[model samples]
Target: MAIVSTSTSAFYERARAGMKDLRSQAETLQAQLGSGQKLTRSSDDPVAAARLRTLSRLESLSTIDKTNANRANADLTLADSAMSNMSNSIIRAQELATQAASTTLTHSQRAGIAEELAQIHDDLYALANSRDSSGHALFGGNNTGNAYTLDAGGNAQYIGSNTSAELPIGDGQSVTRSMTGRQLFNFTDANGNDTDVMATIKTLAAALTSGTADPAAAANDALGSLKTGLDTLSTAQTVVGTRLAWLDVVSERRTSLSELRSTEEADLGGTDIASTVAQLQQTLTVLEASQASFTKLSGLSLFDNLR
Candidate 1:
């Protein structure tokens, strides 16, 4: 194409010169903002950015998993504590029943023991209905709206499920946070054994409160209930202890995993201050020199001295 000599050419030249300088300034500013560090996108630094993006996603997932782990941990601890309390309360009731069963004790003394046993029963009922943080039933599992309700016969009925709520802890690992009242306090061990205990204690108490055929049967029966309950209580306590131990191991692993993930996140997302600063300074120097040279070249005119 033949070159056109008109104001259009001059304007084109001026525009091109301005655009070149503008482009240079933009690059300098971008370097300053980035501080020589690249963004986590394949377009920025394909290989590094891709790797960083993957790492960042993994870290995000791990963070969510940690939160889930924490929730599960809280629920499990609550269940463990509730189970422990039930074990203690039942054991105490058993002791009182044993005392009442003793032949050496007078009828009046047996009555006192029955009264104490009654209080223990009441306490057990309360513990069965225990609530956790946020007012959910601690031992009610996922159906935390209510813990224990009474049947028509006034016996405790578990209103929860067997499997406790679980939370994801990352890497395909999950943990259960809680067990319902039925699972922890009112299973075959807690409920089945307790039935006989109540029978024995009630019979003894009634006999002592009112004149009965014989003082011996009522008291002895109550003592039998006590012995059975103790055995059951021991088993229940061991379950709680085992669960707590598992939770502790998981908790330690959680802590270590968290620290490891944090370090990985730093590697993926954190800026390298020294390298970034140096790159920024170098770009600034080049931009300044370019601008000065462009200013001098653009200002030069062949006709200035002659005019």
Candidate 2:
């Protein structure tokens, strides 16, 4: 019969390796409990870690979308308020025009109305050149300067871009930040001639105060253009309101998506506290048992047994 022999040193080495492995497992569980995460390193769970990275990137993009949505909301709100003021100014101008069209009014009275109309025109010009929250022209599209500039003849000229800049909100969606001055203030008059609200008011004021042959006729003629301009303003207001409502819907969707991502992130990377605690207890118990067994086995040798 052939006898297989194991050395004492080899036996102790084997026992140490086993106990060391158990200790390492216990430490890992303890670390997981302390960190409140299942993974201390990507190597611990490569697939889960990769998914976490993707979720984190998505979360960052969502944050950017939220910021853009907020900015768009602010810019649109400013536009709506400015339009409201312009509408009021236009209504007041209409009333003045109605009074001026009456033959009962004296030349001085008509001149006073023209002065008021000039002031309203100035106000409208300023409103058209209003600045946004970022200090850029609110109705200037992508232009950094004033939306409407005064020409050599004192006429308001739109120098802004034809289209507004678009801001990305999220999920492949975008929104136009604002409308250009030309979009809001300029329109085709009843005579099928192209003119803007400010220019119509300017021409009417000039005729009334500049000793024209028929001031009342000019005032009556401006009534039709003023009505058309008011209608254009109303339509523009409605468009802005619609955009604001759309933003609200997109905001709700973004919130829902954000919540979903949070839930997914928790499910993917969050530790299972109770199960982890139980596992840690079991591993510690096994490690302690192994250590005790190794100590006992190491102390046992031929000399100790003989003694």
Candidate 1, residue 60: Cα displacement in angstroms equals: 3.8
C-alpha lDDT score of every prediction, in listed order: 0.63, 0.90
Candidate 2: where are CA atoms >4 Å away?
Answer: 1-7, 301-307
Estimate candidate 1's alpha-carbon lDDT, on a 0 to 1 scale: 0.63
Give, for candidate 2, the lowest lDDT window spanning 10 residues.
1-10
Best by TM-score, which number? Answer: 2
List, residue by residue over 1-307, the lDDT tens digit for candidate 1: 2343564468558756765775665564465456534453457557666766676687688778767766666665765677677667767766665565567887678678767766676676677677766578776777756677767855556677666667777778766666555444432322355353333444555666675666666666656556665565556556656755765786687668768766755565556666656665776676667677756766766568689
* Candidate 2 lDDT by residue in tens digits, 70-126: 999999999999999999999999999999999888889989999999999999999
Instruction: Candidate 1: list runs displaced more than 4 Å.
Output: 1-37, 182-234, 251-262, 297-307
